[model samples]
Target: MAITTDKMEGTVKKELHVFYVLDTSGSMSGAPIGALNDAMRSTVEELRKKDGEKADLRIAVLEYNSANRWVTQGNNGVENLQDFFWTDLQATGLTYLGGALKELNTSLSRNEKMKAETGNKVPVVIFMSDGYPNDDWQEGLQVLAENKWYRAAIKIAFALGDQADTEVLAKVVGVTKQGQIVPNYEAVIKTNDLQAFSNMIQVVSVSASLAASSSQMLGTEVGAETIVREAAGEGANTDENGVVIVDATSAGGDIYASDATADDLDGFDVI
Candidate 1:
């Protein structure tokens, strides 16, 4: 008789933390809110499908209305994407964007929301808002800008409606070390086109998931900006200053790229 032996090995996969910072203020009610809920549901389904094939995906959700609240609790608060339970959001109250940012800044540390896994890829933050902050958002934003995780992570932001704070959203994502800003979807999405908006969200989520799962693809580091821009397709348009613009067709009439020129904003950095 021959002796038989069994051996086991453990492999630790890198975790990819995805955070959704949503605005559920009263203005998002009706059609806008409905579309957002539907889109998020689809996003969850898409992530779950890619869960096993990709990085160890985890998700955390934050909502701001009258005040900031964690829809999904803790620093290690995220559940595996495959097992995530997304509670549909309802639109109500004020847009306390500052409060939400403050909480996120606090949670960005390794001791908080980032306290999971021995090694992980940079976190991905998807933020959306349809209006201006009703509170002192500048202070909170300052803290966020100072956060190492926030600066190093992949950041994506969407300006949902015409009244949405596009300028502020741009600032929140900031400029990459290479002087590139994180993918800002303000211009590409129409204010009221819920279908288009939803599609953009799903595309961005899936793209980020795939990119974060690996260290390199196509001879380039799969950073947040790279994945976002790739996922945006024709919907993505950025001018010389790196600010994404609305499609020419959506901007009243068609404007040819060859005929366009960069805006000379002496002291401004557009997102």
Candidate 2:
């Protein structure tokens, strides 16, 4: 087997604030939800490998159908998942992408304000979905895009299965250095199998890492035995609610691209 390794000659601390704006509509009932749950659980397991101590890692989950529910945090509050058992989500409602996005925008603003007031590091945001938005996400998207560096953070969009709209996701991902040259550069899992979601998470985490790290675009390759590193993006990234980080030395280190951003602020410095 070939090996992928980056000299750990230097160290980088990234703190992440990941908010899963997922679609828990009735459509996601059967395999999709099962798969999504598995994917999320496996992701946390991998995250646990990174760092599981105190508020050292914060996780936020946003479940949206015709509406949105901030699982970890309040309706607009950003709470740390370090306190709750994050495995209690039900499926019921319509698919209101716009409402979800609007609420999400509010939550982030709240998260940032709280962090600033308490002298905490800024966070990264990730959006995952399997369907298109029923609402006008454009305004929310614009709001997210022009929120200034301090708040407008690195964002990655993953559209799963055929239900997800690639064109829309593409627009949301925006134009990145790596993405511009070769669009769809980030990991996109369009599989029907749920177990594959774990693999998707592995790839996503890598992309998040690339976003948090140096502005080299994603260079990590995805493969079996992908190892999620702890404290990968400590200050600017989190293991619980953090940016995805994959090392070239690990299995799935090559999936991330440079188009992704860690956050709106100049949080983490690349080696």
Q: Candidate 1 — what's its lDDT?
A: 0.71
Candidate 2 RMSD to the real structure: 14.2
- Per-residue alpha-carbon lDDT of model 2 for 142-258, expressed as tens digits? 655544431334455555666776556545545332333122323233334355444656556544533433343265433211122321222221223222323222223332323
Provide the TM-score for each candidate, comma-separated. Answer: 0.77, 0.62
The list of candidate 1 runs beyond 4 A from truth reads 1-10, 74-76, 175-191, 213-221, 235-271
Which 10 consecutive positions of candidate 1 have the poorest summed lDDT? 250-259
Q: What do the candidate models score in CA lDDT, each in turn?
A: 0.71, 0.52
Assess candidate 2 and give its TM-score to the true structure. Answer: 0.62
lDDT (Cα, 0-100) at 207 in candidate 2: 44
Q: What tens digits encode model 1's per-residue C-alpha lDDT throughout 1-271?
A: 6654554434566777888899999999998888889988888888888775646778888889989877875336667775676778899999988899889999888888776656667788888888998988877887677778877777777778678877777777774544344434332233345665676678777776676555665767666556545554445566454544443233322233323445744335645
TM match of model 1 to true structure = 0.77
Residue 195, model 2: lDDT of: 52
